[model samples]
Target: MNHRSLFRRLLLAAAAALPFALSVGDAAAQAALPSDRVLRVVPHADLRTLDPVAVSVTITRMHGLMIYETLFAWDSQLRPQPQMVESTTTSSDGLTWRFTLREGLRFHDGQPVTTRDVIASLRRWMARDVVGNHLGARVTALEATDARSFEMRLSRPHGFVTYALGSAVGQIPAIMRAEDAETDPSRPITTTIGSGPFRFNRDLWLSGQRVVYDRNPDYVPRREPADGLAGGRVVRVDRVEWQIMPDAATAAAALQTGEIDIWEQPALDLVPVLSRRRDIQVDRLNTISTQAMLRPNSLFPPFNDPRARLALAYATDQAEAMAGGWGDERWWRRCEAYFVCGAPFGTEAGAEGYARPNLDRARELLREAGYNGERIVFITSTDIAPIGRMAEVAAASLRRIGMNIDLQVNDWGTVITRQPRRDPPDQGGWNLFVTFASGPTMQHPLTNIGTNMACDGRNWSGWPCDEEAERLRNAVLDAPEGPERIRLLDALHRRLAETQPYRVLGQVDQPYARRSSVRGMLNAPVMVFWNIEKSAR
Candidate 1:
């Protein structure tokens, strides 16, 4: 396909779109159009589990925002603030830390939040890969100081420990009951229980449409004032009805019709149009999210050699791609850095090491890789705001290099079909689709890359298992967030880049749309809806 031909075909390409069908029924609207006092949260997908340890879905991430409270929560700036822990202290050696738990806290079951429960939950996540093998390995041991106090001893210093605790696994300790123990980690939470502001009525677990939770009156918060937010934020809403409206169109229509109070980014293509509308409000995350997409051609045919994959990856003009497909706006940018606001390890690579847009180099590499024209499938999911547009650019670049390519877009669910751990090929079937893996913890490469996803991880592509990658990954763990970390992470990212572990296209923006009535919309690197407590509607 010619570059122009590819553009024309992709820009106008349409997939089987599931109609976003949600209606603010007249019955509810006429029967006292439920007051703004009740915040109606409309998510693109339904929440999956109450068990914080294994809930990996977007809906689970959303529901997690409501039911669970972590030790340290991120503010608009990604700074850690107190949520469950009243105060925390680090040891002189920088390995052991102690957290003074907030008092008067009660789980949904009315059991007082205790140190034992936190320890148990932490142990569960670490022991069984709740979050993954990395975190479990990091935790040296856990001991309760008292009912409301406990200490975490780490094998190495973690600069982002506060932010790390904000992950689902760490937060599991705070949300689940001490007595609630399951034999399997992947199993769903049979009942929802947590120390957050709201408590769900247990009966709604299987309805698949709506999950209900009400405010926990006994809650006593340990205030950590937010920067942009005005005053103290305690949960005000008596009830929260999170509706799982399957389609974005339905969610958008519901929001426009006043059926749903909040609908996360209706559609990326339509953001500009929605921004012009006066009735609804748009909230963009202040964090500048950018990532490199590294696709591997070396694994399969046509791309059987390392040079072939490298040719495509290097040939990718990220600068233009992000602009053409994503946006020149702050939300998108040439990553250069491994992680946006990259941890200390980012310093090691310095400014020079990052992959810059190099068209000439790309062309040369493509030439070196043996330029026999062959079409390849550049696939991705249409769940977030940016991927669809990006797929077009990738297809364009390959076409520009005289490569024939077909673009395939799949739903997020279908793209990431899960299988048993023993079956890596079925997992490879999932690799047939394109998707992005957003780690709960970004600070630890050992945690993120080595354990959870580096070699043969769930959805890992090109079948990776590099011993050197495993070595560098382990070296960075015990290091602090300073120079040592910089050395490890920079090399890790660079190493992965060289190997073409998985095609890293870009770190796409996770856009969310909130109601005008909603207030205190904070931003973080994660998909969090906890600020719903601060929203008025």
Candidate 2:
């Protein structure tokens, strides 16, 4: 069968199995809650981890925002604004900073938020987050002066201190309780207590089926109007239910039937059908586009050699890959720049030769790298449509260039859990995978986790250790925000192109589908459930 026919058949099969997939208890619970008071959504993926600090997955980050509040948060303009902090002061030398917390902030457990929790949380976050590590390197001391205030003394002046604390990208710097924050950063914490506007109902949580959250009655919102991730987080719905439906057709059917109020990410093929419906509104909530990437394991063979990585880059076609993954020329664009295409630091300095696929050039590079048909294990997620399609495109390109690709398909949760393993590809480890990041996360050298080349294995999953790249990155960070900074960024970009830390496949805009009854939705980089109301159908 053709691709379209096969896809239609799969959707039909999935729609047929929807009844068996949903439990009777789940249906009964939906009946118990009033339609206007409950906001039912089909999330992008199954939430595998609860602790956002431990795993950098997008689902955990969304879950973290529901329960936890950051000291600072990015506004609609991408500028840092105080979220939990009442006031802030900095020393004349710019080395010492002090912050005070707003009163009436209490966790779900009914305990007051204090500076001890903030300090402990920052300490743990600094151990994992890329931006946190940069700030941690310059930290002289971080101490809690009183119950409501804390002080941070740095060795040198850092310009993006608040930005690091308020990052909404991968591995968010969410503040937790002192006891929970004190746990080891390498391990995931089971406790789910925070001071955000919503409270996670862990008791009613059914793995792979449903997750629920109730509005916090005692939680105090900001006085200002709601913006991006900043301003007041006013909760309108009594409860938010996350119905995990792996099949796109099933989720789309539910949304059309008013069984679900929102679908986080509907399959691209089904977008046109859903947009034609009067009750459903398909819109792009995030203003910025997301860049898709192909990350290779730099620690293992084949990919360990820069030539092999470059061969893959030369073989893959960005337009073809993006078309296969995103489906529709209007939503996707080819981006060769590592920092993102239209950003300030975005430059395709050394990416001239690898824009389009050159099979001869790729074969030449593979031969020069002494390749002997090594088994390249490419891991993908079937639950996430774009990722799965991107993997297929990449694998096809690699095979055409005479590479042995072993494509392994699994759920998103299993793929994320397996990405961290450092074993050989023949074992449980992976050789490559396709993923995407928000445009804001990839706009800066410091904020982009993929560019980090920390040799100590403390970096992102694919550990790429390059001392020169690290030096250039540090230079870019220290430089002033002007011509000098841009020059340094270009140098860093050139170096990254040579090393090939990760291949930039393309950029695409993803839209969320919500019913007409769902209102007060905010436009942000990531989805937030607050400030939303569900009208009775």
Candidate 3:
């Protein structure tokens, strides 16, 4: 056999041998468990890393939600609500903040959830998350006051501290045990201990195959009714199993056969077939739509030049990109706004630049910028269907703009993992990549990772540096939430467009499928398991 075939066989053999290596009890326990008590799901991607700081993929964040608890959480109405925190008090200057934990909080290991744990967790999160980093910048110190209370003293008053703790966006400040939380921010946690509604089953974790989570019976949910990601998080199912099915057809078949309870993200092409099933119910779950984006690396040539960036922006047709990415006409919308299209801060500022595809204008601009024949390394992920299609459309557009293209295709995990590297393209750096996030995640400046225009080239994957955009972003944070704040946001949007850090392709409709027997699923963007009950066929 050829080397490739032999490697494939060896890999498959190793995967099959993992459960056995863990111990025969692992496989037997999984098979012997009652199916009625377990909720089987096919997540969008595999649960590779447990540390929220190490990775921030949607699926990883979903897993973090299942295994960890935060101090605050966003409600259905997009308001911050107390989750683990009992009450928060801010001094008159808004610089001193005190938070007390709710009663009877305990980690999975039965250790009481103390203020030290909370402080340590937030400290680690502050080093990684953008919201946390911003909050940390103004903080003088974070200390544990009492057994259950923590204090945050800031150098200056900042209004987004409470919101940052409970943020549902990228790198949420998930609380963990003090020891586990003490792990270096640069490294993943050694333990998976958390105080969330579900307890992660470390023994049953099989990387690309399956991972198991049992209901945390000791978890003390809040007295209030469950909202978006806040309030009560009562676990209805006894256990939850995430079976990673890389093939869309296989997952669809599993869902139709009632072998799985929910499919976090079902392929659009197979939605029709799955919708036809009598036992299946398919519906769009995200309250706010999702926006696809093309992020250009500002450290590299071609994209680094504003004229070159504008050339690509002018050449891109959101309608065509949406059509290619999301096939159905009803599945996507042409949104040119930087913020969420239907959100409160949504404005058409700078949208005129992306109104249409002007190839002639794009070519002329490229020529004026002295377009050197620099190779553009475009990263694409085949594991995620929508992203793959979007990358294809982007590649076609760039080629048409007379640019050299080196399209590198890999899995979603690899794409995200490589986007952070700052090496030259030939030495593992990337020129561009396509990704997407829910509208709610991008609606507000506090949670939006895309709009962070840090002056130092130490921002998100693209690494775009614009001091004026950063200043406007800070201005929005300090301003009260009103029309005045929105005006500031519009100005920020215009500057961001001028900098060309990233371009929004369009908005897409994300629909999830579940068995008719499953009920009480929240209408939120993230795939939540709490409050959802599953019945046997």
Q: Best-fitting candidate, measured by TM-score? A: 2
As for candidate 3, its clashing pairs are: none
Error of 1 at 339 (Å): 1.3
Q: Rank the candidates by lDDT, best first.
A: 2, 3, 1
Q: Please write out the lDDT profile of model 1 over residues 1-537, one tens digit for every residue.
A: 444553333233312112222322223422453465566676655554455565344455556656666666655544556677788889998789999887777887778888877776766655444333455556787899899888888897656567556553222333467776434544555666787767776554334466666667876655555432211346666666676665554555566555567775455554554465677777655445435354442344445554565666665666666666556355554554434334433332432433554556666766776756655655565554355656667777767767667666665444333311223322332222233334233333533421223343432234455667667766666565677776777776666566455444555564677667666555544444334543333
lDDT of 2 by residue, 1-537 (tens): 455664466456555545734561256766777879888889999888999888778899999999999999998777899999999999999999999999999999999999999999999999988888888999989998899999999999998999889999878999999999998898889889999999998877988888889889999999988998999999998889898888777887777767788899888777877787789899997767788999999999888888988887899999989999998888899988888888777888888878888999999988988889989999998788889999999999999999999999998999999888899999999999999988878878888889999787888888888999999999998898899988888899899988889999989888899999889888776899998988899
Once superposed on the true structure, which residue ranges of model 1 sit more than 4 Å away at CA?
1-34, 87-91, 128-135, 154-160, 168-174, 201-209, 226-233, 245-249, 290-331, 341-411, 414-422, 426-428, 436-464, 473-489, 508-511, 526-537
Every model's TM-score: 0.73, 0.95, 0.92
RMSD of each: 6.8, 2.5, 5.6
Full-model lDDT for every candidate: 0.55, 0.88, 0.82
Report the Cα lDDT for candidate 1.
0.55
Q: How does candidate 3 fare on TM-score?
A: 0.92
Give the clash total for candidate 3: 0
Return the lDDT, model 2, position 535.
88
In model 3, the runs with Cα more than 4 Å from the true position are: 1-27, 368-370
